[model samples]
Target: MSEPNEALRRLLRESGWTLSQCARAVNRVGAEDGTPLRYDASGVHHWLGGTIPRGQVPRFIVEAFSRRLSRTVTCAEAGFEPQSGQPSQQTDIVDELIELGRYDMDPSRRGVLGATLFSVTLTVPDWPNVAGRLVAVESGRAHRIGVREVDAVRAMTEELSRLDDQFGGRHARPMAAAFLVNTVGSHLRADASEPVRKSLFSATADLLYLTGFMAVDEGLHGAAQQYYLKALEYAGAAEDHLTYCTTLRGMSLQAVDLGHAKRAERLADAAAAAAPAAGPRMRAFLAGQQAHSYAATGSKHQALTYIREAEVAMEKAEARAKAFGSYAPSSLAYHVSQVKYALGDKVGAIESLKESDRLRHSHYRRSSVRYNSLLAERQFELGHLEEACSTWERVLDDYPLVSSGSADRKIQHMKSLLRPHLRNPTAAHVYQRAQDQAESA
Candidate 1:
């Protein structure tokens, strides 16, 4: 171990608390936030001996000290910036997101991924401010974006969405990133009429959402998060409340995928609060996401409540003519399936997904197969091992044709699920097939 951390030791001494007490406080704080720190006196002893905590631990420690001292304290003041660099402060996040966008557009650069800490603490600061923050619009530029250009961007986004649905983000991301760099980025700075500017901002937000989604496909989660934040910023600048909340849903989706259910629920709840008057489809979508977040974090009551709310909202949406928009209407069944599975309603989840599979767009074969594989896993969990193995037959059929990181993960996990049942004939056959498919992939 290195020498004692003078900064942290000084803070401990000034606070007049034993190291064990500080550790317990940090653990309590972590538990309230859905992160079980399990810190004890020994952990504090290590921290004083220059051990830098990882993930959200440093943030929790700072919080613990801050609460005890009745003053703000940052990680750096407590000597916790070595493993990862200090996160960009909340006030500087906008500029940081912009900088992140530039890094993303640079093809030669690779943003953070794999073992890099995702500070849930750093993603959204001052949630209310972000919800209403109005970014400054520049007055003049060499190029003026008009209605025609804005319309063109919207049309392009729709076509890109179709392609992303049919193929995958792997096929469409380069173009989306290039569009942001070549067109949307410049348009944001160009002078235009108020209506045109707002439309352009809205279109840019749409483009950024696509860019962020594609980043997830590429497994650049950190960069994807930054893009979503910038998208929300532009959406707010456009005064488009629906788009802003929509971006929040995207962020929440990523959070759930990353296993940060607590943060996911926070973003989802914030979206629900901000979009009280969104159209039925949008409202249904937000409600479904809340159900997903709640389920992931084991909040069964909250999850089930939002699940019914989502179903009701979607029924209301379908009663009217589908509104023209950039988003696909809420797939209530698909979203609900996730919640059902999380809540241990496995049969319910499978039934919901099967229903969703029927109504799903033909263009999204990758997602369909992925959902089927999930259904199979639930079957396996419930002791129908042979049936579960057979269920994957369709997945393997489509697996070769599709290119998706998410799909790949599903297939990989499903393959693991088969290994335990390999003594059975059907399981043996399916395991061999999975092995062969892996080689081909």
Candidate 2:
């Protein structure tokens, strides 16, 4: 292997990932099409030094290198021959879709795909701030779909929604995000008329937004920010105000998560202004997000005021029209309750949480809220260490087999915060047990 390629290979191994793991990332494309590519360790070793593999396999090679490195990598970075110099190739977009699919699913893979020699040839500009204009849309027209047949982007969006609800964001986000970058992105690149393309654009925007959502769930806040921005641009292009509003709300939520209270508030306010026609549910969700921002800033009065507004919005949403399918109106109670807790209104927070839990469907995947963990925190705060420990243990057992990033971190954070409160003998015993489980995991 040449120097650059050898260095690349060594880096991959040192990262605690196997060659097969890298190969599997690329195989995401092959698995979808039933024509998996095979790469041996030796093959990887050779490719690193500047040997380009034959056929569409190069795309996978780039993807694998990127995932392990946690950065965008190109075929050239891995010492592969430039994509343009390939001897022969198929123009079918499906093959390209496969390549994209592999890249988007994993951040490391995305870095590689982004750096691939052939990327510039793809010619789609960096995803815009919001989708372009959406003047006319011919929904369900075969002429617009052309030879490159598809199941319609909306179908894919619905699939993502179902997965999110059933499996939780942690379990299902990566694949959903990949589907957008690969399949949906492919359709957007196809040669369709303006109207047909507008519909396609809107669908693509939704997928991108969902992809960002998944990224946030996975603890990739920076990547999630970029995806949300791209989705916003696409949404603007689609001339879909609702989608744009939703994207803005997503951005605000992310800001809140990162502790940027003021920015979150501004974004939420902007969303509320832009989405006048948005259903009550959408409006309520935005308001609740704003409430979170206020609470994070320690403005108890403002937070309470926004919470009331959110409640009003939710009631109006439930009574006015129920077609706001993307987000549930009733979730306001849950969010407001959380803000209250953050502001030290423990009693109010617990009450709101109970209401939210009742209204929340089992499929809503509210694992991030960790109400039980919060309950434990409240118990500890009230001088009930034994009850807190018992509560935490129950939560640990509830999802024993699951290894969700959000859940695990929440547990760790809880344990860290309660360390100082372990003076009670029974509490100390429980804390020691929790500590053992955490360390073993």
True-structure RMSD, every candidate: 5.6, 11.6
Give the per-residue lDDT digits (tens) of candidate 2, residues 1-441. 434466457657655667666656566544422346666666655665656667757656655455445456665655555566221233543343344445557767654333322111111122243445442322333233532334456776777766654454665666775676556655655558666666666666677777667666555554565566566666787786777788778877877765557667877787777777767777777788888888888888888888888888777765533122344543676687779788887878766765765676655544423666766777677776777777777666644444455566667777686778678676677668767776776
Worst-scoring 10-residue span by lDDT in model 1: 321-330
Q: What is the C-alpha lDDT profile of model 1 across 130-192, one tens digit per residue?
A: 544546654457877789999999888878766666666666776776677666667767778
Which candidate tops TM-score? Answer: 1
TM-score of 2: 0.64
Task: Give me the runs in candidate 1 sitting further than 4 Å from their true place.
Answer: 6-48, 51-98, 113-116, 123-134, 137-140, 318-330
Model 1 Cα shift for residue 282 (angstroms) = 1.5
